[model samples]
Target: MNLIFIDSIWFTFMLLPFLIFIARIADVTLDTLRIVFITKGNKIIAPILGFFQILIWLVAITRIMKDLDNITYYLAYAGGFATGNYIGLILEEKFALGIQMIRIVTQKDASSLISNLYEKGLHSTSVEAKSNQGKVHVIYLIVQRKMIQNIISLTNQYNPNAFYSIEDIRSVDVQSERINTKQKKYRHVGSEK
Candidate 1:
């Protein structure tokens, strides 16, 4: 019985490092999500994610403190954090939980592109501007991040030479009619009450 007890204890010690590694991964992933949500002005969900992140972090830290002599545990914790950051970024991309403003400048006539955007349910404002080259049309569009690809595809189809820039939007006080319609289809991350 004594020998069996000693073996069990040894086994548990051997397993501790992996367990700590997993916990660190979980906490850091939550930390990444929480920070992203905070930046996006998601008041409702950011705090919730932060709470869980800290909780998991505490658990992992406690294990590390208990096993101060184990170099493996330290390595596992650091490795998990690095891996978690990559995983978190991938998850954020998959979620695409925010809005972006896209600016398109093109020398080509923008009427056709604007009409195409409208037809596709994307609202945009076009202004005639003069650049060093010549007269250009600047088109501004605010859209969900998930729809960026669609907008890009449309732009490429309409005017492949159009210069475009995309910026992350923290909050939009007023949304266009088209955005309102699209908002009904997908839940915006921070828009929840």
Candidate 2:
């Protein structure tokens, strides 16, 4: 009886870490998918993913409770968790689910390029600043990820030597409702000009 109890106890302890590790990994992976889905404008899929993620985590935890002495299991569990998080983030990035802000730093005058972008139905802001190499005109635009190629083409045309940067913009809210109308008119007027 003593040996049986000892064995059971040892088993439970050893496996606890592994169980927790696996459960966390599953949970985080699901969260990563959920965020991606939300960003992609898919309202239905994210919740479904959350449901399965929680269910898997519950099962994993229950198994860990039954065996506590499995040290190797515990270590493996933790390792699996770290690996899962990395995998989840990579998978999410591969999906690329949202709008991005593109910033262009040009070594020369880029007002014409900015004017062209606005003419093409994109909103842009341009400012003149001094850099290490001297004065530069920086242009900022917030565009959908798919529009980046077009923007890049414009940048190459206007400022081949211009430096540029792009970053993901998770959410946006335009405070001025009139801005859209103004942008549309700006495009139409530029075309006619």
Which of the numbered candidates is closest to the native, going by highest TM-score? 1
Clashing pairs in 1: none
lDDT of 1 by residue, 41-139 (tens): 889899999999999899989978976987888888998899899889999999988889999999999999887676555678889999999999999
Clashes of 2: 15
- Model 1 poorest ten-residue lDDT run: 184-193
Residue 31 of model 2 has an lDDT of: 75
Model 2 TM-score relative to the real fold: 0.56
Q: Estimate each model's TM-score.
A: 0.87, 0.56
Model 2 per-residue lDDT tens digits across residues 63-115:
65565765665676667677778989987766555677889999878878877
What does the lDDT read for residue 4 in candidate 2? 75
TM-score computed on alpha carbons, candidate 1: 0.87
